[model samples]
Target: MRKILTLILMGVAVFSAGYFFDKYEKNTCRAGVAYSIGNVDQKFNVSEEQLIEVASKSESMWEKAVGRDMFHYDPKAKLAVNLIFDDRQQSAINETKSREKIAALEQSYEGSFKKHESLTDQYKEQAKLYDELLSAYNESLNSYNSLVNYWNNNGGAPDDIYNDLEQKKASLSGQFDNLEIKRNDLNSLAARVNDLGKQLANITSTHNSNVDHYNVQFSAPKRFDQGDFSQNTINIYQFSDINDLTLVMAHEMGHAFGLEHITSSASVMNALMEGQDRSNLAITADDLNAVKIKCGYK
Candidate 1:
């Protein structure tokens, strides 16, 4: 009888322990994951406060979509979200800077090209006017000389005829002065056009050199696993900006929520970052369904 009672007590104790343990686990899981900003490398240049703000926004994306809390922010939480600065992030930054330099060079080149075009047009118009004026001046000079020669051959001219010849000479002199002014203007335009051409050539050379250097430096395609959730921690490897960071954080948080990759490319739980609208980062129907299924939501 004593032996049977001991076995019964042992069985009750085991069952009680197992029941409480299961209940505790269920309650803990219902409470959701607690996370906080962990080690933020100084090289990332982001303060802890800023990271916390970003983390809150990331948390809200999941909670708002599922209509329940999926993550809680606790400063002492073991689930640390760390910003680790490494070659992945460095390469992204370098590529961005290089593209910005190329864009600036392109804009400058375009402006210079347009100015050069405008100056060339002005040169053409000024040259055309100068040529026409020279032709007119030469024609008038020939007529005046012919009249003068005729009067000389006749030994003398009537006063009216002499007066007319003087008037023609004065008019020709004025025309010559006008032609001289136009010639100077045309020459100035030509000089400006030449200078712009040299300027444009220099710009082209510099732009090409920069492009060559960029190609040599960053020709190889790079792939990065921007962020990941492992060992009770989320590590952000690379991101272009705050918006990108938010998406990465949300994706990792989805993993922490016990959700696996979904088939929907637009879902935050997608294994690959494709078709996701980074600007308006939010969970999709698939993501919400996964959350509901995982958390046993009605």
Candidate 2:
């Protein structure tokens, strides 16, 4: 009787385990994990101001990374990878690859061999995790290649479609026990995100009247401003963003030209410039000449 009961329970456990794995395999990336640039194309309507800022920012970063050398209808440049907003951050600040962790990872890279002349269950667990990570890393590579191919064909696909790419990066990242592979993958994404950030920074810097020129970068909404440095550079924060910075572009240009912040919300140079007007993507002359003043009066 005892033996029969033991067999029944074992069977039940196996069935339950199989059912769970079936569910997991069917849904690889989970909900909200694989946002494609396809959806961003259909949605994401932006005002003119936002458009200029985004275009300028994206272009600037793309230019700086590989440079604008291959802009005239090049398929490869067009298909280059873009950073997802969620993946754009400073997470690496706390990132660590400790010595102990490194040694363990190195061991994982060698692949498991028998210890005590037997393959124990411990080996099985490590092997499973290693294989899972390897699969995920390959998937990311495939995804990047496909996107590049599409761009090279001039497919007009929007980039940054996967709104949750950052989150996905974290989860898929766990599959690799090899620290070097993990580090390289994480660094690649980090470098791309940093490149986007540099472009955004240019937008803010472009408005400084005090400096020869400034760089601006914009990716999100955050309350920030330049308290001083009005003597050397101008930093304008407009509920600052990537999508709608054209007006802020004008306002910053005004500061760059020697104009003080304006009270007239009606004026483009007004410190209180709103998004609607800014989205028009226009910069006024008063703002222009101030920059020209540094260049010499006509």
Candidate 3:
């Protein structure tokens, strides 16, 4: 009976050890990290659902690269992914707004320049036509005056000559009328050109002012870590857009997975955001190798 009891005790100990080891592996090793969306600041203008979707997408990158799951979403998970509103994010937001304003101002300035160019061209053409018309009017008037002077000096003119003078006077009057119309048109164009010039000046002033403001406020090179993992929580402080947010989240998730920063600039585990490809975020080979090493894979 004692021998049978010893064998049973050894079997119980073996089973218990195996059970706890399996649990440990699942919780801290092969099963990956579990995370959940926590505080999403309203200032971000994003919903928790949107964050979850992006987080899921980010997780899928690692999972797909390794052909296994690297993250799990659990409502009760200890890891809380938070979008915390702070000065970092506010600065980024302000920079974005300023850039947008500057872009709009630039567009307005370009449009005004094009309009000014076109109007200037029109003004030149009209001015040229007016000058030509004026020259023709002056030459015709001189000829008419010469003819009248000859008739007056001679004391009497033939009926045919008088009729010709009358016809010349009518033709000169018609030319004068045309010159008046052309002069008015040219004046109108000049006025329009002047108005546009003023408009362009105003736009330029505004654009320059905006540029100055941007330079004053946002020109400094800011290099802060956008997110961090600590105390079992991930705090996201700043991101330029949704893609940036995803890449930041992925970077933090790499930390949560017990991976360290890699030297490769293109790796998701890189220390700096400058080299990360936010648009086409994926786990590089370096990241995959790091994860494999961390999880005890060969």
* Predicted model with the maximum lDDT: 3
> Candidate 2's residue-wise lDDT over 1-298, tens digit each?
9999999999999999999866643332121011111112112233434443443543332224322221112223212212212212222111122323444544543332323113334444555665676776898867755765676588644546443454555655564446456556555655555554554454334423212211122212222131111433323222233433444433443343234654444454545434235444443444334333433435
- Candidates 1 and 3 compared: the better one by lDDT is 3
In model 3, which regions exceed 4 Å deviation? 1-27, 212-216, 219-224, 296-298
- Residue lDDT tens for model 1, 88-187: 8898799789889889988988998899899898888888888888888899899889989998999988999999999999999999888888888888
State each model's CA lDDT, in order.
Answer: 0.84, 0.39, 0.88
Clashing pairs in 1: none
Sorted by lDDT, highest first, which candidate order results?
Answer: 3, 1, 2
The lDDT of model 1 is: 0.84
The lDDT, on a scale of 0 to 1, for candidate 2 is: 0.39
* Residue 136, model 1, lDDT: 84
**On residues 105-179, what C-alpha lDDT tens digit does candidate 3 reach at each position?**
889889988999999999998899889889988999999999899989999679999998999999999999988
Best by TM-score: 3
Q: Model 1, which residues run further than 4 Å from truth?
A: 1-29, 152-174, 194-224
